[model samples]
Target chain A: MGELLPLMLQGAWVTLQITFWASLLAIACAVLGALGRLSPFAPLRWFSITYIEVFRGTSLLVQLFWLYFVLPMPPFHVELSAFSVAVLGLGLHIGAYGAEVMRGAIRSVAPGQYEASLALNMTPLTRFRRIILPQALLAAIPPGTNLLIELLKNTSLVSLITLSDLAFRARQLDQATFMTLEIFGLTLVLYFLMAQAINLAMRLVERRLGRGRIKGGLA
Target chain B: MSMQQRFDDSPMVRPSRRDGSAEPLVRFDQVTKRYGSLTVLDQLNLEVSPGEKVAIIGPSGSGKSTLLRALMTLETIDDGVIEVDGEPLTHMPTAGGHLIPANARHQRRIRGRIGMVFQSFNLFPHMNALQNVIEAPVQVLGMSKAEASQRGEELLAMVGLEDKLGHYPAQLSGGQQQRVAIARALAMRPKVMLFDEVTSALDPELCGEVLNVIRQLGEAHNLTMLMVTHQMGFAREFADRVCFFYKGRIHEQGTPEELFGNPREERTQAFLSAVNEAH
Candidate 1:
């Protein structure tokens, strides 16, 4: 049982690494998608909204399976590892969710901000870079931080496809050693620790961004 | 930073005007503005020379604000052209001297010379007083931060807002915010400045300070000013000329003495009497 603890810990580390890489991909996709949807041009808006709706409408499991099985085996072919497939699939799915959250945050920026930027004769690009992005990021952090935590938990579901995350190791250790209680209990503790740490860090970030607006911030 | 271009040739807003060439600094030629079916401005014609301070007064919905907004290009003209310094506002000519109307980029280039201070003082809430003043000069006018900061300091000093530069808009009182807004507008070094009821949103006691700042700016800066105000006494004191609008058109316009003391139009007479009757 104790031996299984070290293996589970190793798997937990790998799981966290995947979550971090996937979140980086997801946030990049989020910034691009939100900008597309919010663009003044109709074509970009239509393309972004369509991409989000289609991805969000499908099941995440189906997306993972497709990314793993279908995308690599086409007559015009490319190949990737199971871990990469899982991360890309999860990121793609949540990137859609993150885009919507970003859109909502951007919409909440007061109309005066837009008018004020226009009054200054600001170019559209400069306006977004300076005024719109700063305010939108401040508004986006609270809900977005929670979404990232949910993304970490959902990474466990990828262990079903043999990416060897914590949940996969837990099942294997329970089967080999018949010490299900201690091994599975340790896995649960690891997830709790990881998720709580992420939550706490994000709360700190939210406080800094939302300063002066909220009283007793982070509480 | 360099005042060379605007001041080099006799410093006239219209070179022809002060030079006796008679070019109008701003002209609204038979302009009409409509929102859906409601005509806010109808076939309005007006002219102001370089450095003229014109105050427009009427009850709400008389389209005075809309008129100023149209000049700033914040609101598009439905029917006519706005000319600034002998140039048509929405377009310019190529080197060949062929007249081509402007695209968004060109419009932005020309609109650079116009500044507006809103009644609500729409300072960016996330920005502190200093950033709000410096943003346009740094971004739109392409000044470096150090240069922008120096210019911003001068403007804040002009508005008596040097002490409040570190505070955010939400922290400042209404009058202070409006003064900061005036500084922001001035930082652009715009030839034309538009004020849409600048004092209407301030407290009665605070209104005097902001108005005084504006009066000084009007006198000191060679700016073409278009203002919409309801403060009769301030209008009488500050305006080089007064335009009394009724419904959607100017009922009468003249110097303050001619407009206030010897208004020839019946509508102007009634408006002046009602306003002065307010104790």
Candidate 2:
């Protein structure tokens, strides 16, 4: 039991790194995908729809396997490490879901806001950056928090690709020591703690974004 | 002056055209706008001088709001040309003296001289009152933040919201929000200001506060103003000219006394009587 602690903590560190890097990549993809979906140009709109449908419609595990197993063969001879494959696969998968969330939030802004921005002679870029994006982001945060927690849990899937994540370490320790209850229970607590951390961070962000409209709250 | 010569000179070099003497500041020449089969504005021809106050009154769906929306570039006119300050709004002039559809850049440049306030008081919900007022000045006009903040404070003070500078739109009353909206529009220093039923959304008591601010503005500034309103009593006192619109055209127009006191057209009389009964 004492020996299992250090290995599990090391595995947890790997899990944390994957979650951090993949989330950054996911955010980038989500913003690009959402804006592309709403773009006026036809080709960009089509591309966004295709990317979203393809990533979201297929199984996420198969996506991981394809990036890890299939890409290094024949016509598409691209090679990557197990960590890169895990981050790319998880980021792309979660990004498709985040894109829809962002698009709905962007559309939910009142038409009058756009008209007010136009009346002020705001350039399209300034209007989005200043007026539209801030309002849309406020609407996006609650749902976005859910997607992020899912991404953190999904990091367990990286174990299958030979990465030594928390889940991988638990299985190895379980086989070696045959103490399933002790190791797995501790693993659950660690995962829960990390998820709660994400929840707290997102709530703080939502409060900051909504500070202007909320009365009697900290400015 | 020949049309070509007028086009050749810079827009700033043009003479100040005011009140039945020089050229009109705003002209809608046979302007037509249609939303599908419904003709919202039917070949509307109107002229406004540089410092005139025109009140547009009509029943719902009479195209009064549509007329203001067209001038503000919120709605595209289906045909004819709308000109502001001796330049085309819906079209751009080429060096060869041809008029083509105005692009986004051209429209922005032309519409920069105009401002509008909506009945809904569409202030940005996430920004405080002073932020809303100074947003365009800092972003669009490239004014420094300090200078824009100074102007924003003064404008908010003018609208009687000096104490509520940090309040967001959700924190303010309907009338207070509309005043902030007015201050936001005025911060741009537009030559023409369009008010589209600005007081209709407020309660009767609140309407007095907003109307008083507008009356002060009219007395203090030489701005050319156009208001589409349902308030006949306010129009009678505030407007230089009152236009009665019916079925996408100005049915009759005259001084407020001539039009409201003795409406010549039967439609105008019926509309006024109907409006008077509502109050």
Best by DockQ: 2
**Model 1 segments more than 4 A misplaced:** A1-5, A211-219, B1-22, B93-101, B276-279
lDDT of 2 by residue, B46-126 (tens): 999778999999988989999999999999999999999878998998989899999999999988989999999999988
In order of appearance, the predictions have TM-scores of 0.90, 0.94
Q: Which whole-number lDDT from 0 to 100 does residue B31 have in model 1?
A: 84
For chain B alone, what TM-score does every candidate structure achieve against the true structure? Answer: 0.90, 0.94
Give residue A137's error in model 2 in angstroms.
1.2
Residue A128's lDDT within candidate 2 is 92
Q: Per-prediction fnat values?
A: 0.38, 0.63
Task: Give the range of the ten consecutive residues with the poorest summed lDDT in model 2 chain A.
Answer: A210-219
Tens-digit lDDT string for candidate 2 (A1-219): 789899999999999899888888887788789999999999999999999999999988899999998999978999999999999999999999999998998999889899999999999999999998888888888898899899999999999999999999999999999999999999999899988988898889888778667554321
- Which pairs of residues collide in candidate 2? none
Error of 2 at B208 (Å): 1.2
Query: What local lDDT score does residue B80 receive in model 1, on the 0 to 100 scale?
Result: 70
Can you give the DockQ of every candidate in the order shown?
0.40, 0.54
